[model samples]
Target: MDEAGLIERTKNPATRESLRRDLEGMGIGAGDVVLVHCSLRSLGWVSGGPVAVIQALLDAVGIAGTIAMPAHSAGLTDPANWGQPPVPPAWIEIIRSSMPAYEPATTPTSNMGAVAEIFRTWPKARRSAHPATSMTAWGRQEDEITARHDLGDPLGPTSPSGALYRSNAKILLIGVGFNRCTALHLAEHIRWPDRPSVREGAPILVDGERQWVEFEVPQIMDDDEFLPVGDAALASGVAISGNVALAPCIIAGMPQLVDFAVDHWRAAKHPATPR
Candidate 1:
């Protein structure tokens, strides 16, 4: 569908209400901290886009709730010199100047080019436990509903890419599933389900700095094997596959999610999110 059409369907009251019902039934509510993993394309928010979904989630949770999404943006230039590699000169300047200004709400853990303005407004949100493996919000910033554990594997310790749920943590697969879950990586870390595999290194650029960070990509699961399980995982949460292309309303909605996360996660925890 065209972008405008996507926006219209997304803003439809019937679709919105249907989505709200599905989410509420899946244990999303006030007083419950929820870490949402969403695909802006999956929700079909033609009118609202990613921002609308964020607002819908907040309304579901009410004042005493938390919501978060990944704002990671990394740039990789030189492979041989992983950590000390100089940042791409052009990207470096762009990130430092643009990210903070457009969206200044971010912790040190933010990915390349993610605007901090979104998260900075929400002082209390925790970064996701694993930023590299995260699709929404940094690992440390996720709400208490989902807890992350580090496996201690220097190469791929942050995210096991396995299926392991934490206390009170309900996996909201959204439009994607098991392959995308990265839950299996957690299992690989503990050696519970399958054998862990070694992976090659990749590059990424961080905001506000002129250096590149190298990452080791783990072979936790194969795409072919993960397809089926991923589909099953979707049943665990609300699954809406639609298009959303509207720019104005979505821009307005983005801030609400940011505000909700900061207030819920709190600012004191931002520094600790990356580690």
Candidate 2:
């Protein structure tokens, strides 16, 4: 929103302290592992913008805690799959050939919002090696969380989401929804082990040389497909709802939510089958 509109809607400028208090109220605390999906605009006007929000998260979690955010470079995907304002057919080859290799320190996130863009560059933050679906993490356990990102299983058992699940991390939706939750993709992988695969390509460094590589990954449902599961999560008391700043927020145990979604999807897929 415009600056004037944000100021008018926000009762007070959201500062680091206030944001930290709000986060703590939502049950985030020291040594907690949180996977955050946020929209800065939804938080209203802030004193320091994304910087303040990131600091507040750090303050809430303390040095013992760990924080992670999806740093996906979606634009690096094969241009052949581009849909939103798809490039001309003739330009596809040129686009793919010229696209820069994904570098953990230099590549920018696409459509991941301002908070994540800044968080990826935060000091001491470590990012996964996946060319298209890498995740960036900071604080304690950062290395463990971002250590093993497989090209063919970007959101599967070996990716950052898997690490978060293994660590019993909390999925924090700040001014966002479950559709933006990367954790749900893990559920999809678990529930559809035999799901069809899609061939995807990205530019990556191989032995210090840039090359476009192709790999097979399980096909995933669209973001909107997760909405029903999210609604069920809230209705079934799996997700705790609250507010941070002027934006609505929700926090849930990553494992609980993923398990709930798996069951929810299973029921829909096999309504007549006995559990």
Q: Tens digits of per-residue lDDT for model 1 on 55-121?
A: 5666766675555544333322222323454656566545433432111233343331122224424
Which stretches of candidate 2 lie above 4 Å from their native place?
A: 269-275
State the TM-score for model 2: 0.97
- Estimate the lDDT of model 1: 0.37
Q: How close is candidate 1 to the true structure, as a TM-score?
A: 0.49
In order, candidate lDDTs are: 0.37, 0.92
Model 1 regions more than 4 Å off: 7-19, 68-124, 128-131, 134-164, 191-218, 230-275
CA RMSD, predictions in order: 12.3, 2.6
lDDT score for residue 15 of model 1: 42
Q: Compute each candidate's TM-score over C-alphas.
A: 0.49, 0.97
